[model samples]
Target chain A: MKLNERSVAHYALSNSPADHMGFLRTWGGPGTPPTPSGTGRRCWFVLKGNLLFSFESREGRAPLGLVVLEGCTVELAEAPVPEEFAFAICFDAPGVRPHLLAADGPAAQEAWVKALSRASFGYMRLVVRELESQLHDARQSLALHRHSSWKAIPSRCKPQAPDHLSRGLENGYALSRDCSSIGLAEEGGSRPAGSGLAECELQGPTNLLLGRGQSPVSPETSCFSTLHDWYGQEILKLRQGWLQRARGSQPECEEQDRP
Target chain B: MRYNEKELQALSRQPAELAAELGMRGPKKGSVVKRRLVKLVVNFLFYFRTDEAEPVGALLLEHCRITQEEPSGFSISFIEDPERKYHFECCSEEQCQEWMGALRRASYEFMRRSLIFYRNEIQKMTGKVGMGHGSGRGWLVAWLTLCCPPHRTPWSSSAYRKRPGSS
Candidate 1:
C-alpha cells in the first residue's frame, strides 16, 4: 500500500505509558519549572495534528530524544548529536527555578516533547492577538485621514511672501479670498497680461464668479489668450484699493498720499 | 489552462507551501507564513525597483485569473534587478475569469485592511503617531510598489499599445 501523503500523526496520552507518566513528573512537577541541563537538549511535539517536533540543543552538547512522527510512523534518530542544550531560566518565586532537571531518560524526554507542542499552540495564539491589535490601530488612522476637513489641509500658502504666491500658482490655486484679503495669480505664465479677469477683480461690482477651479480653463471666459492679463489687472486693482484704504486710516500717512 | 473550483480550494488549503514555492519567505526561517492569499482576477501589471535609485522591473499578467474580485488582488513581488522582466499568464476559459475577478476583489479588501494595520504599527514603532511623516507612509509606499504597479499610465489615444522603452 502506498503511504498516504496527508496522513499525520495524532498523539494520545494513553499510547505511551512511560512517556505520559514521565511528562507528568518532569513538566507537571510541583513548585518548580522544568529546565534542561547544560548537556541536554529540548524537544517539542505538536499533539493536535501531526507530531511535528522541534528540537534545539545547547552549545558543545549532543541532541537527545529526537523523534519524527508521520501518521503512525515514529522513528528516533541516534543521539549524542553535535548540538548543545540551552534553556532560559525563569524564576517564579524566591529561589524557585522553573527548569525540569529530573527528566533525563527517554520516557521523560518524550513527555517533554508533548508538553512543548501544546505550549507552542498557546504561543501562536498570542502572536495572532498581537497582529490583530496592530491591524485595528491602522484602520483608525486611515479613517482619520479620509474624513479630515479641507481647513485642516496644510495651506503652505501664507500672506507673508511672494515665493508662496508662486507656489500657489503652480498648484492651480490662482485666487484665494478671506473676509478682509484677496490673492490672485496666473495659472499659466504664458498667458498675456490683459486678456483675462477673475471675479475677485470685480469685488465692488460686475463680479464674474468663476466656477470653482475644477478645470484647466476658467469657466467664465472662453478666450485663453487674454485670461492671465485680465486676471493680473484685476489683482492690481484689488491691491490698489487696499493701499488706498490703508492710507486713509493711517494718522501719519497724509504726506506720502498720491496727489 | 486555468484552475477550477476544486483546484482553487485545494490551493487555498496549501498557501504556505505555495507561497514558499513562489519565492515568498517569512522574515525568519521556520516561521509560519502569515500573508493572506490574494488571487489576480483580471490581467494585472506591476512595476518596481529593488531600490529607489535603481531601474525598475516590469511584470505583466496577460490573462491572469484569480479566485475572487471583491478585495482586489493583494500580492507581493520581489525584484532582484530593476531591468528584470517577468510574466505570469493564465487562460480565461470556463469559470477561470469569474474566479479571478472574485479573488482580485477579495485581495484588494485584504490589502486595504492590512495597510491600515501596517500604518498603525509604524506609528507605534516611531512613537510619533498619526497620519503624518512618521505614519508608515514610506512603508506604505514601498508596500504598494511591491504589490502593484508604481505609476499609472496616462490615458493616450495612440494607435498601438506601447510598452515603456527599457532603460
Candidate 2:
C-alpha cells in the first residue's frame, strides 16, 4: 500500500457493564482484526482502553509507538465496522510508506518481514541491555556500601557503648581532643614502688580505666572518659573517610570552556 | 496493558481497603501503605530522568500482575520512557490510590536534593568565572526554579488554583 493511498478507520465500541468479566475477557480475543496483507503499508491496532489504529506507510510505525498517552489524539481517514466483542477501539489505517521495501516482489515482502522482525528484535535487545546496565549500576552501589572500611568500626567498637559515640565524632573536633587526653593520661602514671599499685590518681588498682575506677575525681578516672572520647573520634574519622570515598567515586563531569 | 476507566477506579479504591483485605487492619497501615507508595513514585521520577533531557511530568498507567506469597497483587507500573525505561510500580490496589500522594512527597524531596547539589555546583562555577557578586545568582535562580518547584514562589501550590473559576 502506498503511504498516502492507505487510510485508517477507527471504531469506538462500548461493552455492557453487566457482561464485563475482566480486561482479558473483554479485550483479549482472536477475532479483533486481521493483520495487513500487502507491501509498503502497515496496520497497527493499539488496544489501549480504546483501540487506536494507524494505517500508515511503514515509516510512521515508529512514531505511533512513540506517541504519548496523554494529549492522545487520533485522526481517522475513514469509518470502521463495529465488532460484536467487548467494548474496543479499532483502527485500520495506512502508515508511512516502507521506503526500505520500495521494490515490490514476493522476495521484497519476505525481506520486509525479516527486516521488521530483526528490527523488533534489535529494539528488544537494546531494552534488555539497558536494564542490565541499570541493574549492574545498582549492584555496584550496594557493593560499595558493603566493602567499605567503615563497616568494620561498629563491629570493632564495644557494642555496649552509646550510639552517641559515633554521632559525636561526625559533628565536632571534640572527639580528637578527647583521644589525645586519654593518651596523655595513660602515659603519665606508673605503678607505686612498694604496693605494686599504679601511683597515678587516675589509674585504678587493676590499672584498667572506666568501670574499674575507684574515685570519680582521680586523674586515672579520666581513663575511661578518654577512651570513650577517642572511640567517638575514631568513628567520626571513619564516617568522614566513607563520605570522602563516596564523593571521590562519583564520575567527574567534563569541563566546558568559558566564553 | 491498557486499563479502562473502571479498572482505574478499582485500582484507586484499593489502598483504602488494603489493610482490611490483608487482615492487617490498623490505622497506621493506611499511612504505611501511603508512605511506601510515595517511595515507589519517587523512584519512578529518577527513572524518568534516564531518557529525556527535559522533565515532562506526566503520569502513565500500565498494568502488570505481581505475585506474592499470600496473594497475587495487581500493579500499574507508570512509564516515562520506554527507552532507557524508568518506571514506578504501584503494586496492589492500595498502592494505586496512594501512588500519586507518594509521588508528590517524592517530587518534593527530589527538588530539595537537586537544589542542594545545584547550589554547590553554582558556587564552584562562579569561583571559576572570576567571582563577580551577581554572576552566579542568575544561573543559580534559573536552575533552582527549573529543578525545584517550591523555589518558584509565584507558581507554588498556594498560587496554583487561585485564578478565577479554577476551583
Candidate 3:
C-alpha cells in the first residue's frame, strides 16, 4: 500500500515585514520570545473554507496571533546620517518581547531588508490584484455604457401572476402604460393592499421596483433584472475582499517546502 | 524573430505562458490563431512559435496602453509610437478583459518604477539625495508610525462586507 507522500521543510522567515511583530514590541532582536508572525505559534497553517486558520490561541477561539501586512520599507546601517538608536538586537527576552534589532554591520543591515521585503510581498500583490480587477471591471462596464441597457431576465424573475397585475395577463411583458410601474393606482383603480403606492413610471431608467403585493411579476421578477445583478456583484465584492485579507495572513511558504 | 539568450536568462521570474488569439497587425483586421502561446517574461510580451525561444514579434510595455476596441476587441498601443501595436481578440469577453487588465496594471507599475528611478537619478546628479543619508528610511518610519495597526480599529467584522467597486 502506498502511503501519502510528505516531507519536512524549513521556511526561513524574511528579516523584514514578514517578521515584523506588531504585538511583540518588547522581545525583539535575535532570539527572545518568538514573535508569532505567521499562522500558528510555529509555522504550518490550515485553511477552513476560504478563511486561513493560523496560530490560534485557546483563549481567543477566533484566529489569534494573526499578522497583517501594512506595507514595506528598508533600514540602513552605518549611513551617512547619524541616528540615536543604532542597531538594537534584543532577542534574549523571555516569552515574546517586542524590540527592534539595531544592526550596524553590513550583514546585520540585510536583516532589515528581509523584514521589509517579507512584509511588503502580500501587500503589493493585493494592491496589484485589486488594481487589475478594478481595471477589468471598469473596462467591462464601459462596454455596457451605451445609452440605455437592462439585464437579461434571471431565474428569480420567472413571471408569477398576482391578483393586481390584472389586465388580461397572458404574456410576460406587461406593456401597460396604465400600470406604468407596479403599483401607483393605474388610471382609476384604488391602490392594492400590500403595495405602497410609490410613483413608478416607465420613462425613468431605474423605474422597476418589486411591487409590494399587487405585482403580477413574481417577487422574483418584480424589480427587473437588477436585484439579481446587484446580489451577484455584492457576493463578488465580498469574495474579493476576503481573498485579499486571507492572502495577507496566509503563512509564508519558502523554497524548501516544494517537494 | 531572433532569440536573445542572455536577455532571457536575465529575467527575474520564470515566464508565464498564456494562450491568446492574436489579431493580425492593425485594428481588429482579421482572425487570430489559437496555436501560438504568448510568453510573458519580465516586462515584455511576445509570442514564439512552439518551443522556439526567439519571439516572432514583441511589444514593449513601457509606453503601451491596452484599450478595449469598441464592440468585441481589445488593443494595446504604444504611446510614443502609436503605429506600433498588437490587437487581439479573446475567446470570450472575460478572457479579453482579464488579460488586458493584467497587462495594463503591469504597464502602470513599470511606468511608476521608471519615473521613480529617473527622479532618483536626477536627485543623485543634483546631489539632493545623498547616498547613505537614510532619508528614505526616515520617511518610511514616519509613514509606518502613522499607519501601524495600533492607530486603527480592528477590521474583523467588516472584513467581508461588500465594497463599491464590483458593481
TM-score of chain A, all candidates: 0.21, 0.18, 0.24
Q: Model 2 over residues B1-167: C-alpha lDDT tens digits?
A: 22223222222222121121121111222322221221122112211133332222223212211122223222222222222222233446555434333333222222233323333433342332123232222332243234334443323322112222223
Stretches off by above 4 angstroms in model 2 are A1-47, A50-69, A74-259, B1-47, B50-60, B66-97, B100-167
Pitting candidate 1 against candidate 2, the one with the higher TM-score is: 1
lDDT score of residue A156 within candidate 1: 18
Highest TM-score among the candidates is held by which one? 3
Task: Name the weakest run of 10 consecutive residues (lDDT summed) in model 2 chain A.
Answer: A1-10
True contacts kept of each: 0.02, 0.00, 0.00
Write model 1 residue lDDT over B89-108, tens digit each, in one string.
Answer: 22333233333333332222
**Candidate 1 deviant stretches above 4 angstroms:** A1-6, A9-119, A149-259, B1-167
Interface quality of candidate 2 as DockQ: 0.02
- Per-residue accuracy of model 3 over A168-249 as CA lDDT, tens digit each: 1110011111121112112233432111112211111111111122321112332434534633544455444434433443
Model 1, position A202: C-alpha lDDT score? 23
Model 3: how far residue A232 lies from native, Å: 9.8
Q: Looking at model 1 chain B, which ten-residue stretch has the lowest summed lDDT?
A: B15-24
The TM-score that candidate 1 achieves is: 0.18
Better of 2 and 3 by TM-score: 3
Tens digits of per-residue lDDT for model 3, B36-139: 45655334466655665555554445446788875456777755445544666666777776666556534324423322343354344334323332323232
